[model samples]
Target: MPKGKRKGKFEHRRTEEKIYSSDEDAGIDMTIDNCSETSGQSDLKSAHDDAENEQEKLEEKVLEMIDALSARSNAARAGAMVSLRNALQRRHLAAVLCNQRATLADHLAKALRRGRDGERRAAAGLAPLLALQIGEEGVEEFVNEIRPELAAAAADKSASLETRTEVMSQTFTYV
Candidate 1:
C-alpha cells in the first residue's frame, strides 16, 4: 500500500473506538439512556443498607455464639465453636471479630482448660480462625491470651490423642 493510504488507515484506527453491537459481545451495558439518576442512587443506597443489615445480623449471631461458649454444657460450647468456625470460614468478619478477639481467645482457653475432649478439640480448631479474623497486628495479642491454656492442653496426656494432636496442630497455625 502507498504511504499516504497506510497513514490514513492508521489514523482511522486511532480515532475510532471499538463498539460492540450485541449484548454477548460486551460484559456490561455500554449504551447511554436518560434514565433518572435518582433510581440508580436509590438502588445503590438500598444495596448498601442491605449489606449493613446482613453484616449486623452476622455480628449479632456471633455474639450469641460467644455467649453460648460460656454455657455449662460441653456440647453447647463445642457446638458454638463449630458454628463460629463455620461462620469464620464462610465470611470475613474482621472488623467485628477484631474487637471480640480477647473474649473469644479467653473463652477458647477456658474450653481447652476445662471442657471435655470434644470441646477441647473444637476450641483448638477455632484458635487459628480467631487469629486469622483478628489479622496480623492482633495475632500476637490473641496468642498471648490463649497460649497458656494451649500449652497446658498440649501437655495434658489425659486429653484424647486426637484432641492433643488437634491442639498441637492448631497451635502451630499462628506461631
Candidate 2:
C-alpha cells in the first residue's frame, strides 16, 4: 500500500456509482401530492357551491310563484297555481317550503274565497300538494289554516257544480 492509498474493492465502487438520497426525492414528491390534494379539495368545494346556488334559485322561483297567487287577475292567479303545482311535482322542495306553509295556506284560502271559478278550482287542486309537501307533522296546520275557506267554497252555490264538487272532494281528502 502507498502512503495515501488504501486497498479495498468497495472504496473504488463508491466513487464509480451514483449515490441516491431519499430525502430530496421525497420532498419533491410530497410537495406535488400536497398541491394535487389542495386542488382536488377546491374542486369539490366549488361543485358543492354550484349545487347550493342551483337550490337557492329553485326556492326563489317557488317563492315567486307563491307571491303571484295574489295577483289581481283571475287568469294570473289560476296560472300561478298551475305553475306552482308543476314546480312542486318536479322538485323536492320540502325543506324550502316547510317554513312557508302558513303563508301558502293563507294565499290558497284567499284564492278559494275571492277568485273566479278557474282560480278557485286551481286553488282547490293545490291543497293536497301542499299537504304532501308539508309532511305528516305540519299538515294539520295547513288543513286548519285553509279548512274554513275550503268549507265555504265547497258549499258556495254560485260556484259551478264542478268547482263545488272538486272543493268538496279535496276537503274530504284533507280532513
Q: What C-alpha lDDT values do all the predictions have?
A: 0.87, 0.88
Pick out the ten consecutive residues of candidate 2 with the lowest summed lDDT: 25-34
Structure candidate 1, residue pairs in collision: none
Model 1 TM-score (2 dp)? 0.74
- The TM-score leader among the candidates is 1
For residue 165, model 2's alpha carbon misses the true position, in angstroms, by 2.5
What tens digits encode model 2's per-residue C-alpha lDDT throughout 69-134? Answer: 878899998999999999888888888778888889988988899888998999899888998898
Using all chains and alpha carbons, the TM-scores for the candidates as numbered come to 0.74, 0.69
Best by lDDT: 2
